[model samples]
Target chain A: MTTPALEAKGISKRWPRTGAVLADCSLRVERRTVHALIGASGSGKSTLLRCLGLLEPPDAGSILVDGALAVDQGVVAADRSVRRSVGMVFQEPSLFAHLSALANVSLAPHRVLGLDPESARNRACSALDRVHALHLADRRPDELSGGERQRVAIARALAMEPSVLLCDEPTSALDPLLTREVMAVLRELALDAGTTMVVVTHDLDFVAAAADSVDFLHAGRIRISGTADLLGTRGLDDELDRFLQRS
Target chain B: MPRVLAPLLVLLATMAAAADDGMARLRASGIMRWGCDISGGAPFAFPDPSDPDRVIGFEVEIAEELAHRLGVRAERFSADWLALIDALEADRCDLLINGFEVTADRERVVAFSTPYFRYAQQLVVRAEDRDRFTSLADLAGRPIAVLNGSASIESLRSAGVPPSLIVEYDDSLAPFTETILGRVDACLQESFIAQFFAGHDPRLALVDAAFDPGIYAVVVRQGDDDLLASVNAALASMRADGTLGRILQRWGLWSDAQRELGIDRGPIIATIPEAIGTPPEDGLPWSLVLWSLARAAAMTALLTIVSMPIATFVGLLLAIAILHGPKPLSRFCHGYVLLTRGTPLLVQIFLLYYSLPALGAWLGIPELLTWNKVVVGIVCLAANYAAYEAEIHRAALQAIPQSQWDAARALGFTRAQTLRFIIVPQSWRLSLPAIINDLNSLIKDSSLVSMIGVQELLAVALGIGKASFAVPSMLVAAAAFYLVLSLLADWFGQSLERRARTVGTLPEPIHR
Candidate 1:
């Protein structure tokens, strides 16, 4: 009965330099859901996720956060307010290399929310603890390992307390053990806090094992979508199935 | 026709208004501003040894007396000795009481008051060579030093000395110093200058005869007859009261030439004033020399420090504007950089400090920005270095990775925030070494400001060298000071760079 936690309708984008295009793609994630948008490289899934996070505005699209219009067609609904409601974790850790892990995680709340430093730092600490990265909080990104950096990055997003989180390949650079650990942390955040997450990845195995819902993106559109169980039985559209199998 | 005639009449009225009000202005203000160049040193107008800030010379004493007789407070305006006429014409000062030798070329530009001192050019040679070069013809093949634009040039030519064999110097004392250093065989300079600058040294001796006697006088702007009359009357009274002779006597400058000119016809001074600093020793006094140069070194350091921040700030804004501003504004910044960097710094200083005021006067604009020598030096130095700094910043900014901007913006930072937090810090770190190198160059380039009349370290050292004829040693001391100042700047810059590398954190020093 509740509206999906995040929704995109009719998203499209184009690169003027090379004439690449993403046409008419849409996706929805339910409250507390672990949704994976799966596609091969160059399928435009990462671009769509970035557009949903408002990092790059889509040429055309409407994005909704908790059924409220956060972006209408080409215009962003609000700048900091809309961005505050939706958080994103990049494919790489993308931590501010100049900052300590704690400062990196606390920067947005301190800068955007005008939270006093102490409270912002405390909130950052709690977010790090959520991802079990408390030990790495004082270290710089250069000092942290691949998995620790990702975890700190996740903490950076979680500290913002957004309604929806979009992550692009959050486990792409990790080993299998660290991948499982990061997945487990994400699953726990979804289950405990009822936070919705939409992850873009080519990891079909990750989708099959961890996603509550799945969308198969090909070319520029979501070619197939269903609950994981249904998608597991039905398979993706034929071409994408083969593509996913190869990836 | 009437419209044209009306404008012509207005123009004539304005010219009439501009006519000489010199004496009236002096009376109204109650201050007789004397234009002078204290860097001329010693017998003319030089820094007092006991208090270097208080200038003292024979001319300084004469100006005080003249101002007293005229019932006004005396004020001294320091100008480049070479540019004193320009200062007088600019109405920046009323009289030039510096050792202005009367010459027809100068009289064509400004009126000369009655002769205050008269002297013939004296030939000076090293003590050992005093017997070798007795007459001008004896110096036929050897190098002889003469002041540039002095009456001695005509005397040397008339003496049958080949023009190519004579070395001319623009500075007042360079000829004498060059002679003492044996860079020239002999020097022909005014007799009074010989007494003060070269006569003190044991190695130099003045030949008994003097040549081409000339008078020194107060210079007033042409057409300022009212001011000229008052200055002449003051000179007559000083001559009557023996004040003029006493001042010349104190500086050890009273000579036969003054009596021959019929001005100082008073009794000859038998004893030199005890206050005259013991005649500069045979060579430079290194201890006192270093002490004097240290003050100049401090001034150079202060100039560098004050102007560099301005250069850095201006360079930063210029770089940002060139890189990020709209098309027209960016183009303007590019043009500005090209113009400032393309021109010689000396030319820029001259244009800004000298030519610009002339241009302002021609344009009839009031309150045009004319600054003192030091300020003009700083402004020109900052502006010149700013162009280089801007280019450094631009290259550094461009070198910043795009990923940094993406990361900052992805965190919801505005464009300005992203630039301030992510881009500028990295760019500045990348550019610090280059900027510091430029700063070292700027410190050396600061000496060029002296040409515009800033009495910075090198200028001060040159003055001492001129006074003592110890150019080589004084120049060596100046070189050491500049070397140390540059080294200090380098060390400071490296320390800053180390701190910047740690991203604003002060790291603990490493110990073995």
Candidate 2:
């Protein structure tokens, strides 16, 4: 319903020397739903999320945000203003080292959205509060713990007020305790803000706890999709089971 | 057996006497080395303007002529005026023809031929200030510039002129220019030198009163009795045959005063005096050493003050341009570095001093003034070194983790903001040592200012050496000056580096 907040149809990517990282991958998320993409390493799960987020355009695909096509037939349209409605968190904690968490979160809104400093900062503060990171908003990335930095990163992405959020292995670098804390913050933001999210990760616990729906990616293709409870009960298909076992 | 012993003894005595005679030894060797001054005091002895290796002057001509009369070819070597006596004493040269003034002190260590020419110690002033003095007394309590160890200084001193009144210089020409600039009341120098300089500059004129007569003679090492006798014999022959007059006329030293006063045709008069207080004035070298130290210190301070901001600003821009500017702009900056580093610093200075005027003309900019030339020289020096500095900065920037850039970008910062806030400060620490080294080099290289006529330390020491004939003292002073300043620069550089390390360790990101 609600025109599926975000959709990707037949997305494929071929990197030179690393052919077909993603092939014929498709994903769709309902309004305000958290969709988890779980796979082994090199399964193209992160690649698919990047394509859907418009951070890296898919080699061949159609991406639609709010029922409007943002990219189709290997070309982004001249007026793909839908990028403003999508935000991303990379696999690494790619925070702006030059700026504190608060400034980092506010920069895009001020620059791209043309929001003045006061309004941009107010929105940033709200975003930080949603992720429970408002207390550490002024800290630089170097000064913060791994979980804290990831939370700040999540807040920075959410500050854009994007209709769809993409997270690429967001907690991979954190320890177990920090990883759980970061995932908890992400789940809280998803629930409270009602934000549509496509989380690309290899963590089964994160997928089971946070995701409403699940997709299993294997060798650049989405091999299975279902409600999280059903996917968890049945476990993964044989190919994904083997892939996850090896990982 | 007794007869054989007698014959062997006779042969040995003959060989010993011939070996002890220096003139005979020189003839037997067939190589005669003559010392000449190359410090650009033309007409006496100086390096040929077009060819630095060859020396040309009245002294050169006389040395060559005397050597020809002795049937031995002569080769000239240019040396600092104050070093000439040492060179002679050390057997580095057979004779010195560096317009060496015949003074009582020098006679103790070196033998001299009869004086060939008499020069008056005349005061030179701006034409505007020609009437500024009527006598030496008029300069009392005022700065009267003189070459460090010249007859003028002695004349002024013996005339009871106070030390406070004399401002000794290392260069022959600077005192006159300094007077014109009103830095000094007047400059006392040889009449020939004063005339030569005043001839080219309409702004300056020679004062009419003669303060002292500078009698110049050819000098040979002491105990070279044979060489001294041969030289005196040649001088006597020249005087008898009018050859000396022809030589003086050829050099334009046949002054009207010589003719009007009938001094040239008079009987050969010897004013040769007993060797006096010191063998050559030792004060010239001492003053030189002091002047050099002062110059080195001043230059180090000036370069540090001027280049720090320049290197910081230019180095930052260059790093940014290479890292983030348009591809073509980055390539252009790289080319600039390659070109500057490929050439010599001396060539760069020459280009700035001489070629810049033409460039200015082509660009329709105003002609560069003397002061402008100095500024340009400094700028050129800084720019040449800035390329190296930029490379240092570039490396430092590269040394920073790539995560830093990603983090900044993720924070929604544009490339410019990320670089300004995150990259530059870290790079500053990495580049500190190299920048300090470049600063030291800049201080030492500032000595090149002498070529373009800026009277920095070395130039001042040279002036003093020429005047005082106390070359060793002045050089010692200059060396001492340079050493102290270099040490100070090292201390400052080390301290700054330590501070940079401490600041670098602070865990904050560049931006708040």
Candidate 3:
């Protein structure tokens, strides 16, 4: 009867230009689990992940983080709890270009966590080591290779010591080999380090290998919700069977 | 007026009256501040070459004696010669007293004291041609340089010199300088100037043909009868006791024409002090000339340094408000940039330095807008450049990609934190070249403050060029100064860029 690690119910978002992009979407992710929100482009999967991360507010829904109310019915408090508990990795390869990779990783810990310079740097080094990006600490983002940048980005999220990591297509900009490399790092973080993550992507092989549970978001709602074994059992739904055929 | 504000209005009225009555202000301050254009070279208010701070000229002595008679020491206020009269009308000085002639037209705006010295137009030509062009009539067809606003042009025209053949120079020794350079055939100017500015030169000689007699006098604001009467009495006493003769005789300006003012004078003799550096004939020593230029350059540099930081800060605030402030404030800042950019910096200098005080008076805020010249110079410069700097900064701030802002916010950063750490530093790199370009031109424009009587590099060149008659040399030296400072600014900008370069890339060395 332990509460789910993160939960959302009846989440809806309306954009001024494109109305009702997400409508009454719901999901539940258990602790230390790799949950993937998968859909084609414009399916509102990213919008739902953004809502879970508090990057955006849903027009109507409640989000609970580890059985605690982080947002209710679009009424968000001045809540540092959500910010402190969740770390976000965006689809864009975003880094502070003026700083070195190490400095970029260390900045939030020192500023947000109020760590001293030496302690923040140590935390960043250990996080980078965990993702096997320790050697790229001195390079600026422009100097790092594509796969190396994604590894360092994962390390940046890890440096925050978050209970949940919300990633929006972190491998969308990478090639197949680089995408395999980044998904391997994510799988290792989930299995070995017990870091919970909700990844939003449409990579089928990645879902087959890394996801413990999957939500098939179609037309802004969770149309298929089950364990990753559902991808192997595709005859149940015609749309799901066709999605597997294309991949 | 309401009873509560009655005391405040009376206080303001008293202040307005005190500011207006130049004589009372002089007496109250115990310093009779007199206005003169220092470029009125030798025996008129030119700076002493040995020590330019110790202004030594016949007019300087006359002003001192007049101030002593009025029970106050004289303090000299120098402005551009063309602006000295406006300076007087603005109450920047108690009276104007730099060789003002007693002309009927001048009498309409300002009252004149009795003539202090007498002069007539004289012809000056190359020493080798002095015999060939001894009179104005002999110079009819050749190029003749005459003081632009003086009686010389009328006299030259009346004596049958062709109008096309006449070259007009504004009231400085530039006419005679053209004769020295062999650019003109002859110069027709007053005798006193001809003697000091060109007669001292071994290459030039003054013809004995003196015509179009005029008399120099002190000028006071028209309704300043008390100060006018005091100045006239000082002149009369100086003449009666021979102090005026001694002063004029020292500069070789004593003339037989003084008998008309009731003074029997002694023989005229030239006696430029030996300690006052060398004469104009030797030209100013290069070391002394450069030293004056160095001081002037320092003023220009100091003005740039002091005002630029303020300008950049003001520009940054303006840029931020335009980008991030509420809609009305953003629009207002954008409009401010447009308004400031549309106007000339020269007009801004005059409006702030001159018209602001006048406006303040009309608004019944006595002395509210009055600032010292240097302060006014800084204010005007800082404000004018702020408009351009704001535009540069706005572009720079916008150039930092939104991805970086999203990254910082996702890392739990507040808006201010993101701007301080992530946005501004990167934007500064994008905007560096444009900001430095603004800075380079601002160094050059610092010289424009001289229009407000700021004695920076170019003003020094004007003063020394006129006094030494080495016009070309002094001017070239001043130009070299501005070029050096602009190069230094370029260097500073590049060094900062190199320090902040992206980690692994090497920036190319600047090619000359």
Per-model DockQ:
0.21, 0.10, 0.33
lDDT of 3 at A191: 78
Q: What clash pairs does model 1 have? A: none
Shift of residue A181 alpha carbon in model 2, Å: 1.9
Ranking by DockQ: 3, 1, 2
- Quick one: best DockQ, which candidate? 3
Q: How would you encode candidate 2's per-residue C-alpha lDDT over A26-114 as one tens digit per residue?
A: 87899888999987878888778767766567789898888988888767654525776777787677775646778767867776567
B77-166 in candidate 2: lDDT tens per residue?
A: 544455455435434467877767899887765688777778888877778766767667777788889887677888888988888888
Over the stretch B94-145, how does candidate 1's per-residue lDDT look in tens digits? 8899878898877766789998998788999988998988877787788889
Better of 1 and 3 by TM-score: 3
Q: Which ten residues in a row have the lowest lDDT in candidate 1 chain A?
A: A228-237
lDDT of 2 at B261: 24
- The 10-residue segment with the lowest total lDDT in model 2 chain A: A227-236
- True-structure lDDT of candidate 3: 0.78
